[model samples]
Target: MTRTNLSDIISCLSGYDPDAMSVTQARQVINDFVPPLATFEKLAIRSALDRVLAQDIVSGINVPANDNSAMDGYALRGDDLPASGERTLPVVATIHAGQHYAHNVSAGTCVRIMTGAVMPDGCDTVIPQELTHAATDGAVTIPAGAVKTGDNRRRAGEDLRTGQTALRRGKILRPADIGMLASLGVAEVAVQRRLRVAFFSTGDELRSVGEVLTPGCVYDSNRYTLYGMLKRLGCEMLDMGVINDDPAALEAAFRRAAEDADAVITSGGVSVGAADYTKQIMQQLGDMSFWKIGMRPGRPMAFGRIASGDKEAYLFGLPGNPVAVMISFYFIVRDALLHMMGAEQAPLPRLQVVSRSAIRKRPGRTEYQRGILSADDDGIWRVRLTGEQGSGILRSMSDANCIVVLNDDQGNVASGDLVQVVLFDGLV
Candidate 1:
């Protein structure tokens, strides 16, 4: 498929300004630029957990297959019920689950039925066993108004009808979905191939684990965090170790990543700095854009598609600070990757809760403050900041259970004020 030029996409967005792009605008650009992968692979339902469906699953037969009893009771015609007194009906037959009663149930006669047992030919209702009293002469007594027609009877195709779409395309299959597919007698299904993401960290002052930490160098923690996040999203990852601050090395890394994966994510060198060579390399390689986004902690970001000879890949250049990298990724890159994987993407829900402390903020920029959410004595949900809010403070991200989102127009938040927050439970 032919990809739309990044410039063309940008030109179409009204008031599109890279220098002062809002979080919403940046997300829209990425959404419009990334396209879902068309390639798909068929896999057994047992192995298809968390995979996006490539095709709709049409049911071949009705679920339950026949009109069945939903309760262990006596099945009889609804008209046989008494107007104001008890009615006794002779028990003609007993049917268990997986059994079919072929004889018609005549008026004043009932069949003892177990759950999942097919209803008798003339039975249209079932009075639950608990509501019926047994008689000595092989009969059961049902009280007036005990049940109405169709009460405890499950109609055929109630769950899924023949030729109906049981599951739609772009669904991320879960355990329940697997069970549903099994109920439909589907052994295998077509799902979109996993998204390939190549990520790396860049800095001369960065060292991998097991390496001796020099005076000015720090151990690289970004790659490990990136790995955790991408793994949770079920992406196939390529972790290219820390690249040095050199033009040639940066260019080679970008080319290799673009050629090898469907998308490339780099941690450093996007921000304005003398030693930052990643931005230059990205611009030289593809249609990249460097922007100072209107968000705190992660203001500087780069996004575009980079090419490596015949192969091309989308690029996301995040900030060097640890906290900034995570915030940028979760807010910016996560949805784009899901789209590329052909999965249905929904916005992460932001819950409104009261803040327990005063927060410093401004009106023009958005801020994502790490916060701990808890229930008060009154069982009301509340959030408090995780001490200092610094872009480089990785510990803040760990201690917090949610991120308090302050919109661009929102200013300082006072104690007891309500704010919007996104939880990190399934996300982080």
Candidate 2:
């Protein structure tokens, strides 16, 4: 519906079960309604912990930069070794790491070197000190032994070379990648700006968690839950706090949340209910779509945009139930947020796990049954159900280490069956 027609709030956001919209269909709608935000900024290297690389990082110098010893050894020209007996090679000069070489190996000569020391020039092999006999002077005798032409020597640029792509755009830098960049002597990196997100909860009956339990009022948790997950992704967030279920208050909160955020996310008020003002107010001022995606515990989720001049800030309305929020974040918003950040599109990891019990489910909705993964003695991962799959029971979500992903077309899963398990460790 157009913004003009949306001015009149819909008393009922469709009765369509979240399963009515397929994941593909929902993603398409999200793409059509919410476009990516404009790019901005020169972020500091240390500040870009999880941000996507906006530009390709190239090495200015080779990793290792020069040939160095992989172990403590004697640098010698293999061909210069004597045919028999102890070949006395004068220890010409020592070459240690981080120091320039003043002497190169001459014929019948070698040097005592430590691991990481520059391989002396004109030396083709390294005889680890343990393999050789000691001498009185700064010299060692080499006994006849097997020696490869260039063993134990790490060549310059062997790991990476100057002008080679060290890191690509859209790659989320891991700890190893960070060290690799540092090895290239890169103290700074160009990365996409951290997405600024805003979050809030809406319900007149909800009270702050620390406050005393009042009659008919439950503790507010959506704001903190969303905040925690987003924080783990390195998001810059603004907590909009809680706006009571009143329409005017909801409208003011929505306006403020969209004011400085790339996205504004809420936990409730988009379902087929009369009092869900978050949906009503969103319809009035922005072009937002409320979809009941075909997914369990997360069917009431919505995705769209806030009209901001010629642009629209993205919006994701999560379900009120705790488990539904987790599911929506994993199956929906996470990818879109990654795309928005310019990170390369990597498919979410999926695993084949053995089910410990039968799961009752329907064909239309994809169910994410919370479960604990057990590793057998053979080291294979198997999944077992966590008691009662109620979406509102936050404890089950907390104790769960993985989710058994039941396909949309499949229903009940019997015990001893192989199923897909999406791990909570970020790997799967």
Candidate 3:
């Protein structure tokens, strides 16, 4: 498939400015540039969970396939029901589940049917066993107001009719979806292949875990967090460990990641610091945009498409701060990756809840403050900021259950004021 050029995508957006981009503008650019993968594979239903459907699943048979009893009851003709008093009928035969009575049930006689048993011909009503009394004489008595026509009977195709769509394309299959497919007698389904995502962190001061901690060096946590987020999204990840700030190493990492995966995500080296070689290397290999977004914790970001030889992949250069990396991924990269995988994704809901404390804020930029959401005594949901909202404080993110989103035009917030928050549970 022909790929859309990044330059053309950016040019089409009104008021596009990379240096002073807003969070909404950056998101729109990524959404417009990314395209869904067309490649798909057929897999057994057991292996298709969480995978996007490639085609609609159409049912060839009715769900029930026949009119059957919904409960253990006496199947009788509705016309024989008496107007005021109880009526007794002879029990001609008994039918268990999966059994079919071929002969018609005559008036004044009924069949003792178990749940799921096919109703006898000419019987349209079923009086539940508890509503009827059975005698030693092989007869049952039903009260006048017990049941009407079509009671306790499941009709054919009530759940799904022939040639009806059981599931639509682009749906992410869940456990219930798998059960539905099984009910239609489908053993295999066509699903889009898992998205391949390559991610890494860059900084000379970052070290891997289990290594000796030298002076001015810290262990990398962004990669671990990125892995967890990507795993939850069902993407196959290639974790390229920490890369030094050298220009040669940065260029090689970008090229290799682009060649190997459908998308590349890197934390660090997108800011305007002198040692930030990632921006230069990315610009040289592809049509990249470096932005100073009007957002807190994650203001510096790089987004574009890069190519290596005949392969090309989308690249997202996030900030080095631990908390910023997470906020960027959740707000910007998550939905774009889902779209590329051909999954139908609904926007995460932002709920407005009362604030538990006053918050200092400035206009002209968005801020994502890590928050703890809880219920008050009256069962009203409220939010409070995690202490020490620093970008490098990864613990704040761990303690937070939601993100308090302050819009670009919003200012300081007073206690008891309503604030918009997106729950972490919903994003994952």
Local accuracy by lDDT, each model? 0.93, 0.77, 0.92
Instruction: Encode model 1's per-residue lDDT on 273-315: one tens digit a residue.
Output: 8999888889899998888899988999999999999999999
- Model 2 residue 394 CA deviation in Å: 1.0
**After superposing candidate 3, which stretches have Cα over 4 Å from the reference?**
134-137
Q: Which parts of model 2 have CA positions greater than 4 angstroms off?
A: 1-19, 31-33, 80-90, 134-137, 141-146, 308-311
TM-score of each: 0.97, 0.88, 0.94
Q: Could you tell me the lDDT of residue 296 within candidate 1?
A: 87
Give, for candidate 3, the lowest lDDT window spanning 10 residues: 132-141
Which regions of candidate 1 deviate over 4 angstroms? Answer: 135-137
Give each prediction's root-mean-square deviation over alpha carbons: 1.4, 4.5, 2.0
Better of 2 and 3 by lDDT: 3
Residue 44, model 3: lDDT of 98
The digit string of per-residue lDDT tens for model 2 on 282-317 reads 878676667777888788876667764454467899
**Deviation from truth (RMSD, Å), model 1:** 1.4
